[model samples]
Target: MLNFGNMHNSVWIGVDIGTTGVRAIAYQKNGVNLCDSNEFYPLETPYPDWAEQNPEIIYKATEKVIRDTANTLIYKGIPVSGIAISTVMHSFAPANEKRELLSNMITWADSRSVEIVNELKKDIKLTRNFYEKTCCPVHACYPFLKILWLKKTFPDVFSKMKYIYSLKDYVFEKLTNKWVIDKSSASASGLYNAHKMDWDEDILSFADIRKEQLPPVVSTTYSQKLTPDAAQRLNLPKGLPVVIGATDGVLVNVGIGAVKPGQLSATIGTSGAIRMLTKNPKVDKKNRTWCYNLTDDMWVAGGAINNGGIIMRWMRDKICHYNSRRLDDIDIDPYDLMTLKASKIPAGAEGLLLLPFFTGERAPYWNSELRGMFFGLSLNHSRSHMIRAAMEGICFSLNCVLTALKDFGKIEDIRVSGSFTKSTLWLQIISDIFGENITLPQNSEGAAFGAAVLGFIASGEMNSISDTANLIQSKKIYYPQKENFLTYKELFDIYNNLYQKLQPEFTRITTYQNQMYK
Candidate 1:
C-alpha cells in the first residue's frame, strides 16, 4: 500500500495489458509515478510456434490490477481524474454475436499462419497491394493472415465467429460493452487502410470476411465511460471516463517523449521495436517496416524483433541453471550476475558471433524458419563468452531494424525503455552498436506512462502530446565509445553475411522438420 496523500492534487491511472502481464500505474500530471501494481498471466504454447492466452484470465488480471491501484489511491484521498488503457498489438480473438469468446487470443508471436504468409508472398501483386494499403507486410503475425489460417484450419470456429477483436478490443468490450478499436491497434492488423482510417474492403475479401466483422476504428484519444457492473467490480466510480489509448508500441513513443522528428525510441522487453514519429504514414519501398497510427496526423514507423530479453531468460533457465539458481544465496540478482560474468569477456566476445533467432525473427527479415546459431565458436570459448555474444547478438538484431528505419527518417538519438535498461552493460552495448547516444527517461514505465499522458490530455491537464516532452525528465545518457563502435561495425558485417549464407539452410531445415512431423 503506497501513500499518495501529499502528491500532486491531480492523478491519472494508466493500465497496460502487456504480453507477459497486466500493469496499472498511477501518475501525477508532471509525470511522477505515484504508485503502480502488476499481475502476471500464463502464455500457453500448446504446439510449436503457436502462442495463445485465455481472454477471461487476462480480463481478470486487468481487473485485479485496476482495483488494487485505484483502491490504494482512493484510500490516500488522491482524486484520480481519469483512466486510460494501452495494450499489445496484433492480437486476434474470435467472438460470437453475444461477445462470448469463441477461441483463445492469438498473439503476435504465434506463427501458425506462416505457411499462409509464404503462400501470399508468392503472389507479389496481391501481397504488394495489401502492403501498400495497410503498411504491414504479409506476415503470419498480422491478423489478416491469421484470419485466413483460421478459415482454412478451423472452419467451424471461423463460421461461428460474428466478429474478430484484438486483445485490447476484447478487454474494452468486457469493460464498456463496446466493440470499438483504436486506430493504432487497427493499423497493425494488416486489415485497415492507413489513409482512410477504416477497414480495407479488399483485404477483408481476401481473408473471406466482411468489414462488419471488425470493430469500428476510433481515435487514440477516444473515451467512453465504464459500465456500472465493471465499475462496481473494479471498485471504481461509476461513469469514470476511460480514455482509449493507442497500442503499446505506438504509445511507447509518447511515453518516452520521442514525438520529435529525428528522435527514435527503442524498447527491449519480451520483444523489441525501434520507432520514429512521422507526420504522415511512411511506408518502405521494400515493405520491411510497419507504419501504424498514433493519431490521425501522426504515425509510428519502425520494425519489431520477436526476440529480445526472452533470449536472456532462455540462457538463465537452460545454460546458467546452477549459477542463476544460486544467485539468491549470494545476494545478487541473476541477471546482474550474468552481466557481471559477461563483462569479464572482451568486446566482440573474443571472435564468437551469435545470431539470436531463438524464436524465429521479425523486422528486416520476417523469416519464421530462421533459427538461432552461434557462428564462430572455438574450443577456447567459455560460458561467459557465450553470454557476451548473446547480448551483442540482440543488439545486432536491433541494429538491423535501425538500419531499415533510416529509410523513413534520420535517427539523431535514441530514447530507450524496457527491462533491459536495468543493465548498464546492455545500455552501453546498444549505444556502441547503434553509434548513437541513448537516453533513459526518469519515468521508464513506457506504455503505461503514455496512457497516463493520454488521460491527462483527455482530462485537459496537458495541452498536447508534445507538451509531455517538457514535463517528463531524463535520468541518464550513455554515449557510444568509438573503439567499441569500430569493433561492432566490423562484426555487424559478418552478422549480416552469416544470415544471408544461412538462409537456404534455414529453409531446408524447415522442410526436413515438417516431413519428420508428417
Candidate 2:
C-alpha cells in the first residue's frame, strides 16, 4: 500500500534472503522504499552447536517474496526495473553442476565442524597460511571447514557435490544462471583472499576444495539478465539486471553510511555484528576478529555474536511468558512490552548481568558450550530488570567487539541500525556503553537499499557506491551521558571479570551438554 511513485519515475527491487526469512522491497530512484513482502521459514537445529536450514525452504521463500512483490507492483502498473539480493555470509549449500541442492546449507553458527577447526589449528603453517591468504581464521563458522566436515563425515553428500555456493550465490544462480559471488560475501567465507581479492589456492588446498567447486567471485555490482523461467516465476520482465550484493552485515554499514575509516556500524538483528571499514586488511593476533573485503580496496573488520535479538526473543518466550497473558491481543508483540519495561530500569540494570549465550558465544569466546546465565539475580530484581539486563548485556558484548577493533585501528564514531535501534533508550544505553555518540539511520531500508545502489551503479544509473551516503541520512544521534558512561564502564569490568570466573563452569556445562546431546 505504500507507494513512492510510478515505475516510470524510479523502479528497482531489493531482495534480502536472510537465515529465517526472505524479503523483497520495491524502491524509488532516490532510495525511498515503496513496499515490501517477506516470507518466513524456520531454521533447523538437529544437534547441540549445530544450526542449518533447507536450501529449498529458503529458495521457496525467495520465490514467494519476489513473486508477491512483483504482483503488487503489477497492481500498481509499474514493472520493476531490476532486482538485487543480499544475504548472510558463512552459509554454503553444495550442488551438482546443474545446481541442485546436495544437502542443507551449513549455517555460520554450525559448530559441527569443530573437529576440523581443531585439526586446522594443529598445523601452525596451515593456520598461518589460511590467515595470510584469506584473512579469516580457521573457525567452524565458515564454508571451508564445513565442506571439510561433510567430505570426511558425509562422503556421499561431498562426492555428489559438483558446485559450492553460498546461500546468496545459489539464489542468484537460480535467477540468472550465473555462478557468482560478491567480494564482501566471498571474503567472509574463509575460502577467498581478503587482500588479494580472489580465492586462495593454498587455503583451498587446506580444505581440499578445488576452484571448480566455488562460485566465480564477482563485484557487488556484477549483474546479469534474469532468466526467462525466473522472470515468469516472479512476474517480472525478462533480462532485468540482477546485481550481486554482499553479506547483509557489510551492506548494513553501507546502508547507515558507516563506510568511513573511523566510523563503524554495530547492528543487532537476528544476530549481532560490530563492523568498521578498513582500507587495508587487519587481522587479530589471536584470530578472534575477522577481516573481510568490502570492496576491492575496502575491507570490513569485525566480530559476530550469534545471540543478539535472539536473546531478547528467548527472554520474552521462556522467561517473561508475556504472550500467555495477552493471547487475545495479537496487535501487541511481547518484545515491545519487554523493551518498554527495560527502558524503565536505570543504567546497568542494578548490577544484573546476563551472559546472552543461549546459543553459545562467538568473537572473544568461541566456546560452543557456553550457556546463558543471569549472574547476581536477587529477589529484588523484577522481570523489567531481567529484560534490561538482557538488552544491556547484548550491547556490552558488542562493546567487547568494539574494543577488539580499537586494538586494530581507530574508531571515532559508530552508526547503529536494526530493529533494536527503534528504541531510543536502547540507542542511548549503547552510546553510554561505548562512551561515544551512536547515530541511527532515518530510514532502515535494510541491505536492499545498499544492494539497489549497487544495482543502480551496475545499470549505469548511479556513479559509485560512495555516492550512496548522500541518499541515506541519519535521523537522530544519541550522545553518551557521562554518569551512565561511568556506570557502564564499571559494570563492563564486572562483565569481563564474570567471564573469567565462569570459564571453567561454562566448559563443564558444555561438556555435559555435548555428552547428553551427542
Candidate 3:
C-alpha cells in the first residue's frame, strides 16, 4: 500500500477548484500530504447543451474546503507559509462590478454556443486568424464563442452587463478583491493573444465586448494578500499570501513532476485530457488540439474529452444501481463493484461498443452535436459488458487526443493520474487501448499538490520551481499486452469509422432533441 501521508516539515496549503467541487490539501516539502478536506456542489443540466453551476454555490464550496483545511492546520499547530489556487478553465459567468453573479456558471461542458461558433466558421479567415492568435479552437468551451452567444441571447435592457469573468476570477475576487486571472486561464479564453500575452483587440471587437470588461491577465504565479474579511471567515491569519496558480490541467503535470519534454500526463477525472509541456507556444494547424500557457516559457498542448469516469458513474447510478453495501453489510466502493463485474468480461466486450459522448465532445472533434450511442450491442452483452465498453470508449477517445499531441514530439513516457488509478482494470484497459506503458505516481496528489508548490515558489519558501521535480516518484507501471493491444487497435478503427458514418444522424438527433425541448 502506498503511504500518501508521509510526514515531512514545512507546511503549505493548495486549493483546487474543480468542476464538481473543490478540495484543499495542506502539504509538506517533498510531496508529503499533511491534511486535506473536500466539498462538492451540483452540475445542473436543466436544458440540453447547457451545463450550469451557480457561481456563488461553487465559491461557498471552495471557501468551506479552505476553511476546514485551515482549521485542521491550526489544530495541528502547523503554520502554513502560503496558499495557492488552481481552477478549471473556460468556466464563465457574468457579474457586476460589485462581483454579484448575474448568471449561472457556464462550464466547459456547456455547448450552448454552438450556433455562434457555426456562424463564425463561415468566415474562415477570421476563425483561422483567431485560432492562430489565441491557440484556442473555435469551440463552445472557450469564452470567445460563449461571449457571442451571450451578446445574442441576453439583451442589454434585461442584463446587468457590467463585467464578465470565469469562476476562477469570481473566487479570486471574492478572496482578494482583485479582478484578475492567471495567464494559464486567460490563454485558454480564446480572447487572449498567445504571442503578445494579452487580450486580442480584434477578437474582442468581434465578440462585442470591451477590454475593460474582462479581467486583467497576470502570470500563473502572481499572488496577493488574502483580504481581512476573507481571512477571518476562513480562520486563517490576515494578510496570508494567495498565489494565483495555473489552470488545473497544467497544474496536474506540475503535481506529478512530469516537467520534461517527453513526459506526458493523461488525466481522467470528471473529464479526460492528454497533456504535454512544450517549451514555447504550440498551436495545431488542423485545429484538432489546444495550447495554453503554464508560464511565459511553458505551454501545454493537448485535447480534452467531455466524457471520462462520468460514464462509469452513470453506469453505477443508473444502469446497475449497485448499492455501496452488500447483504452482509460489508462496505464496497461502487466503482470497484462495477470494475469487478467488468473484469469478468473479455477484452473486446464481445462486440459491444459505446460512443460515450453523452455531453458532446472536445479536443479533436470539438463537435457539440455528437450524442451518445450504443452501437453493435448484442443480446449476449450484460451490464458488465456495456460498462467495460464505456471504459474502452473513453480510452479510445483519449487516444484521439494523444494522436494529435504526438505532433509536438515523441511521447516517451505516459503518466496517468486521477481517482481512476484505484481500478487496476481501468488502468490496464487504458494501457491496452493506447498500446503504451502507463505509469502511476506513488501519491497522485494532482492539482492541489501542484498548487501548493506554486504557492511555495511564489512565497520564497522554495528556491526554484525545479525543486519540485526531485520530489515526485513513480509507484507502479502497467504494460500493454500484445493480444489485448491488437484487439483494441482493431476496435479503435471500428470506433472511428462508426463516429464518421454517424455524424449526420447525430446532428439530426441533437437538433430534434433540442427542438422538442423548446
Candidate 4:
C-alpha cells in the first residue's frame, strides 16, 4: 500500500510521443517536476523520401516512459492524479478493424506523395475548397496525400485495410481499448472539417473513404480508464483517467502560456513551427500556413518546417566524424562542440548561405521537391563556416513562418521551447534573425507539460486552461544585437530571393534524383 498525500502534492503525468523519441513528465500543479523519463527510437527510411516507424516499437517506448515515471512517483510517495497524451501530428498507418496496423507509421517527414500533392495543386478551385473546410494545405506531409500514395503504390495493403490510425490513436487504443482521435490530431489530418468539427464528407468521398473508416473525433479533454493489460503494464489503477490531449504544436503553446491572440509560440523540435492561438479558424489563401483546433473554441494558426534540429543532427553524424551520442564513446555532445565552433564564425558565414530544406519544407513553401544546398561555397570556407551557415539556414526557415504570421497582428510576445534552448548560440541566432527578444520559461517541457495541464482539468484538479499561466516563471531572455540583426535582415532577403530565382532548378534536380533512386 502507498501513503496518501496532500491534494497539493498530487502530480499529473504527461506522455509526449514525438518523431524520434518519447518523453514522460510528472508535473505538480505548481509547475515543478516530480519525475521524468525519456526513450528514443529509430526513424526508418527504407527508400528515398520515405519516413516510417514501427507502431509496436513506438508504443513500447511510450509504455516504458510512462511506466518508469509512474513507478518513480509511486516510490517517492507522490500520488499521481491522472495521465494525458500528446503526439506528433499527421503520423499515419492503415489498420484492420481489429486495430492492427497494416504497415509502419508514416511520419510527417515522408514526401513520397509529392506527385499526388502536385496533382491536387493543379486544381486551384478544388484545392481552395478543401483548404476552406480542412484548414490544411495541399501538401505531401498530410495523411490524405499519404493515403493516395498508398493506394497507388500498394493496392494489396489498401484493399485489406479497414481503418486508418494516427500514432496517438494507436497508443490510446492500447491503453484504454478505445480507438479515437482528438480534434487537434484529426484537424491536421487533412480530412477533418475545422468549421464543422468532424470528418469532412467531401474529402471522404474524394479519398474513397468513409466516416466509419476513421476514428471518432473527440475533445482534447476526453478521458478514459486504463484497460486490465495497460494497468498491469504501468502498475497503475485500472480506473486511472487517461485524457486524450491535443497535438504537439498546439499543446506547446498551452505549456508555454502563449494561449492568447498575438502571443507567438515558436518550437524547433525534430521539426520547427511558429504558432499563435486565435478565436476563429483561418486559412491562408496562399497556402502558406495551416490552422488546427486547440479546443472547440480555440484555433492554432501557424507554419511548420521539416528541418530544425535534425539539420544539426545531420551535420553532427554525417559531416563530423562523431557517432550518435548514445553510440559514441566520447564524453561530450557533438552538438555542443558544433555550437562552440559555430560561435567563432562571424554572422553570414562569410557570404555562404544554406537552404535548410533537407527534409523538404512545410510552411511558407509547402514544396516537397525543394532540396537543401549551400550557396557561395568556396575553398576559403572551413567546417566552422559550414556549421554556422547551416544553423543560420534553420533560423531563416523559421523566420519564413514568422513572416507569414504578420497578418496575426504584431507579435505581443515571443516564447520558444525545445532542446535548442540549451544552446546559447542557437537562441541568439533566432533572436538576431527575428530582431525581437525571445523568452524561455523555467519549464522547457512545453508539449509534455501542456498534456499534464489537460490531465489536471479532466481530473477536476484545475478549473481552466488559462490558470496555467500563473504556475510558470520566466527563465532567461535573449535579446537581439543591432549589428547582427542588420546583417541577418539582408541575408533573409537574399534567402527569399534565391528560392524564387532557383525554383525551377529545384524541381528539375529533384525529379532527376527521384528517377534515379526510385
Candidate 5:
C-alpha cells in the first residue's frame, strides 16, 4: 500500500507502443515515476523473413495497459495531467475507410521486401535521389520498399486499402477517431521529404501510392482530445488531452537527456540505434545514416542496427536452452546468469566472433540478405564464450553507427538506456568499444519517459523540451579502459573486414534459400 497523499502536484502518462509490448507509465512533473504497467502482444511470422502483428491485438494490449495504469494512478488520487505516445517506427498497415486494418502491421524487422529493395538498387541514380529526398536508403525494413512489395504482390489488398497507417496512426484513430501521423514517424517511412516536411511525391509515385492514401502528417506536439468511448475504455476523463509524440528513436534521445548537439544516445533494446540531435538535417555523403525530423528546428541524425539485445535473447532461448530453462525454474534471470558467465571469458572471447544479425541488419550496411554467423569457433570454445562474443558483436555493430554519426558532429560521451543497461559488463564493453564514457540516467524508462516529458511540455507544465536535461539525474557512468579499448580495436578491425568479405556469400546464400523455398 503506497501513500497517494505524498505524491507530487501533477502527473503525466506516457504510452509507448514498442516492438515487444505496450507500456503505460505515469511520471511526476519532476521526473519521478509514480507507476507503470505493461501488456505484451505477440509478433506473427507466418513465413521466413516476414514479421507482422495484428493491429487490433496491439490496440487491445494498449487499452489494457492504459486502463491499468490510469486506474492505478486514479486509485491513489493522482490527477492525470496529459498523455503522450511513443511508438516504434517504420511500421504500417493497410486499412479500410472505417480505419479497420485490412492486413497485419508490417514491422521494421520484416525482410520479405528484400527482393523489392534489390530491384530498386539496380537503378543507382534513382536510389540515390530517393535517399537524398527521404534520408532513408533502399532497405527492406523501410515502409517505402514494403509499400512497393505490397502493391506488387497483393494487388487486391492494395486496391482495397483506403489508407495506409502506421501502428501509431492506427491507434491514434482508435482513440480519437482522427487519422494523423507525426512527422517523426512519417519521416522514417522513406516516403516523406524531411526538407519539405511532407510526403515525397516522387517516392509516393514510385511506391504506386497517392498522397490521399496516407494519413495527414502532423507536428510532434500535435494534441487532440480522446473520444468518449476511448475515455470510458481507459477509465479516464473524457476529452483528456493526448499529445502526438515522436517515434521511439527520437524519444529515446529525449528520455536520456541527449537534446543538444555533441550529445549522443545509444539505446539497445529488442532493436538498437545510436542517435544524436542536430539543428539541421545531416545527410551522410555515403547515405549510411538517417536524418529524421524531431521538431520544427531539431532533427535526429544516426543509424540503427536491427540486432541488439535480441541476439542475446536468441542465444539464450536456442543455444543455451537447458541453462536458460533451468535458471527460469529457479526464479533467476537467465540473462544475468549468461552475463555472469560471459564476464569470466577473455576480452576477445578467445578469438570467437559472432555477427549478431539474426534478422539481417540496418544502419551502415542496410543489407537484409545478410545473416548471422559465428566465426573462429574452436573445440575449446564453450557456451559462455559464445555469449561474450555475441555481446561484443552487438557492441561492435552499434559502434559502426557511432562512427558514422561522428562524421556529422562531435560526440564526447554517450547517454545510454534500454535493456542493455541492466548489465554492467555490457556497459563496460560498450564504453571500451566506443572508447567513450557511457552515461546512464536515473530512470531508464527510455521512450516512455520521453513521451511523458512531451506531455508535460504540451500541457504547459514544462517550459520547453530542452528542460529534459535538468529533469533527469545521472545514475551511473562507465569509462573506457585503455587495454580493453586496444583489444577491442583489433577485434573490431577483424569484425569489419569479415563483413565485407562475406557480403558476396551472404547474397549467394540468400538467393539459394529463396529459390529453394520457392
Candidate 6:
C-alpha cells in the first residue's frame, strides 16, 4: 500500500456514476475541490420510452475516470486516501455469480413498464400494503414493477438471474468485491422499508424475489477496503478504505449543506427534484411527495418531476430559430444565450404560462398522457417571450411541488442548488412563486462533494455529518417580492386547474397512440 504519510494533507475522492457519464472528483477536508475527471457513455433507447445503459460500458468508463484521476494525482505528487460511489436511484439489473452484469441497467427514466405500474396502482391490497411498509409509491421507476415486467415478458432472463442489483450496488461490487447497499439508496428501491431499515418481505413476496437476490443493506458509514483487481484498474493502492455512499440526490442536498429542517433543496439536471429532510418518516397521504431515508434517523420528503432541463433542450433544438442563424465558430452555446435573452423579458411573460408536461407529469398530477401547452398567448408573443414563459412555467411546476409540501406536509423554507441556481432570473422566479427566501450554498459540487464528505467522516476525520453542513457558506439569497406574490398565486391556481380540465382530452390522445403502437 502507498504510504499516506507522504501526502500533503488528507485527500478524499468521490465517484458519481450518473445517467450520462461517470465523474471522479477529489476534494480536501475543508470542502475545496482540487481536481476532477469525467467520461461520457452513450445511452441506448431500443424502443420508445425504454432507456438502458450497457452496464459493462459504464463500468469501463468509470474505471477510466478513476485511473486517469489517479494518474493526474501522481503527476502532481498527490496521494489518494479513500474513495466512495454515488448514483441515480431505483434502477436495477441482474448480475451473475462473478459480479458481471447479465442485463442492461434499467435507468429510472425508462417507462417500458408503465402498464405494469398502472395495474399495480389499481391493486389496493398491493399498493396500500407496499406503501405502508416501503414509504414509496407504486410507479414505473420502482424496481418491483420493473421485476414484474421482466418476469412477464422475459421469463428466460428472469429465470437465469442469480441476483438483482441497483446501479449503486453494481458499482460498489466492482470496487470492493462485495455486494452491499446503504440505507439511503435501499429505501428508494420500493423493496426496502425506510422506517425499519430492511427489505420489505411483503413487497419481496409480491415481486417473487428472495433476500439472496439482493445485496445486504448497511449504514451509510459502512466501510470496506478496495480489492486488488479494482485497485490495479484504478491505479490506487490495494486495500484502501472505501465508504458506502448515499444516492446522488440525497447527497446533492448534503453537498450543498442543506441538512437543517425546512431547508428545501431543488436540483435541475437530467431531471428535477425538490426535497427536504425531516426527523420522522412522513409520507403524503395522497402519495404526491415521496419519503425516503437519508440517514438512520433522518427522512427526505419531496417529489421528482419528469420534465426539467430536457424541455429546454427540446426548445433549443426543435423550436428555437435564432440559434440557427449563428455561425459554428462564434463560441456561443445556444442554451446560455437563450437563457440570457429570456431574462430580458418581464415577469409573467406578458400573461403567458407554459404547461411543461412535454414528457408527461410525474408528481402532483401523475398523469402520463398530459401534453404541453402555451396558455394565454397572444399575437404579440415573441420567441423570447415564449422562452421566458417556458422557464417560468418550469419554475411554476416546481412551485406546484413546493406548495404541496407546505400545504400537505407543512414543510417550510427551502435551499436551492444545481446549475440552474447560477441564473439570477431563475432563482428570483423560484423565490417569488414559492413566496420564500431561497439560499444558495457556496459549494455546489453537489453529490460528488457529499460523497467525499461521507468518506471523510468514515475515516474518523469528522465528528458528525453536520460538520460538512457547517463548512458551507452562502454566496447569495433570493427573497420573494411581496407585490408579485398575489399574481403568482393566481397563476398557480390556474396552473392547477389546467391539468384537471385537460385530463379527459389527454386520455383520448393517449388511447389513440397506444392503439397505433399495438
> Which candidate's TM-score is highest?
4
In candidate 5, what are the lDDT values of residues 131-156, reduced to their tens digit?
88888888998998888888889989
TM-score of each: 0.95, 0.93, 0.96, 0.97, 0.96, 0.92
Best candidate according to lDDT: 4
Candidate 5 deviant stretches above 4 angstroms: 1-8, 322-329
* Deviation from native of the Cα of residue 311 in model 3, angstroms: 1.4
Clashing residue pairs, candidate 3?
none
Cα RMSD to the true fold for all candidates: 3.0, 3.3, 3.8, 2.2, 3.2, 2.8
Q: Give the TM-score of candidate 3.
A: 0.96
lDDT of 2 by residue, 134-232 (tens): 777777788888889988988988888888878888788889998788888888888887766889887787667799888788888777888999888
State which candidate, 5 or 6, has the greater lDDT.
Answer: 5
Local error of candidate 3 at 477, Å?
A: 0.5
Candidate achieving higher TM-score, 4 or 6: 4
Better of 1 and 6 by TM-score: 1
What overall lDDT goes with each candidate model? 0.86, 0.80, 0.85, 0.88, 0.87, 0.79
* Residue range 425-474, candidate 1, lDDT tens digits: 99999999999999998877779989988877776667677877776678
Model 1 quality (TM-score): 0.95
Q: Which residue window of length 10 is worst by lDDT in model 4?
A: 1-10
Tell how far residue 442 is off in model 5, in angstroms.
0.9
